[model samples]
Target: MLRRNVRLRREYLYRKSLEGKERLLYEKKRKIRQALEEGKPIPTELRNEEKALRSEIDLEDDQTAVPKSSIDDEYANASERDPKILLSTSRNPSSRLTQFVKELKFVFPNAQRINRGGQVISEIVEACRSHEFTDIVMVHEHRGEPDGLIVCHLPFGPTAYFGLHNVVTRHDIKDKKAVGTMSEAYPHLILHNFSTKLGERTSNILKYLFPVPKPDSKRIITFANQSDYISFRHHVYEKPGGPKSIELKEVGPRFELRLYQIKLGTLDQTEVQNEWVIRPYMNTTKKQKILGA
Candidate 1:
């Protein structure tokens, strides 16, 4: 009887230990799933434990839940139907940005202004998603020019923050109708990646918001490369086969977008912008090797 009692107590203790282990694992998975759904970057400690959990658990994963990494990766897509743009700024309204946001409204009729309200990019991203905003165009101001523009697509993104150069408007241009027609064409695009492979990838991104002119028409857009500061050829070009000529009249909306943060192909600019800023003092020298942009 004494031996039997001892054996029974040992088994009870072992069973309790097993239950505790299972409970801890359940919490880990719950945390991982929550973090992934919120688009939080998983902590390295949690990531390591996740590897360990994979080996410890042999049962098939819960059918309703996906791997944490897969859920995190889903943010790379722009899942919305229409491009509902939200214009935002980080600092308090610097008059210039305020004015641009206002003009941007007339230019992009549906584009609406959202106050920063001391919230960080992560919160802004979540807010945009909750409000069903499809894209975000954030203006970064310095001196007089709205020198930086960040574009983020929601619910999963290809976010781009560009260093703007030579911004122009209809009032500033000689041919106002030429610029007006570009907008009227509805989804006209001029994207240059400086090289072919990069251009194709970048074009897909701009296409999500500004889809190609449906069936093609005569609206003009001008995009230049990283090295080319001399001239921007503005015209409508013939398709690859036919005449292979361009109607080069040399007039269009004047603007230049040089890529500053290429990570927009995958990550959220709202989230990443927290760690970056435009350093006018740094200029083009050390600025070439960016820590974060």
Candidate 2:
């Protein structure tokens, strides 16, 4: 099993490294095809390769016309299988953090929470990987308040680290009447204002955490991006009269997530390159948005 895993990882990395060349070739083919269709001379730079590109284009069909990115491989089979998530907290977590983790367990449909105990991150990651867990979510707290969240995708990862803020768990909600009952059904997702490339990448990381919801599922989970802070909300709706008379209820445990970094490797890998990271002190406009336009 170990040998097979290593070989597979090597193959995956090689394929990813070739994506740039594949994209370039795809552009060349596109340019030649466009010039031919418009009855114009081929672009000067592409003229020498026109014959080869044209022949390749002739052999291509609808599916081969577009190039696929390496990013797509990360969650290629995500839709085919229900996401199995492992939720845990930092070692010797506080009572408040424990309760927050419990609330999170119910938030994700197939998630299972385990006591962190004295286990290290590497051990936890290996155990989850062996168990075929799709993703791992670890929450950290500072002075009994949940302040950090790490989401690591298994087998291969693009782990995302977020700083938690304004966390309001279900137990903390004093107004009992306003809180909606937690539903175990898979919730439909609403991702709003994720317009930029980084925004879309971040959106994909969060979106695959939940399995595909049934069309009629009343539970709704939303991740809305504004000024780079992602606001997470949970809710359930009811149509007492009809579709026109729909009523919405807010579920507790809402929070804001500010992404700090995204690593191309899993949580346990210390030497991996960072896919993206926030550098707040760098020279830039104060109003610049990283997650949206």
Best by lDDT: 2
lDDT of 2 by residue, 124-228 (tens): 888888789999999999999999999999888989999999999876666575465588999999999999999999999999999999998999999999888
Query: Model 2 off-target regions past 4 Å?
Result: 43-48, 178-181, 281-287
lDDT tens digits by residue: candidate 1, 105-124: 54442577878878887676
List candidate 1 segments past 4 Å from native: 1-80, 106-110, 117-119, 175-185, 192-196, 216-222, 226-253, 264-293
What's the lDDT for residue 71 in model 2? Answer: 76
TM-score of 1: 0.50
- Supply the global lDDT for candidate 2: 0.89
Give the per-residue Cα lDDT of candidate 2 at 248: 81
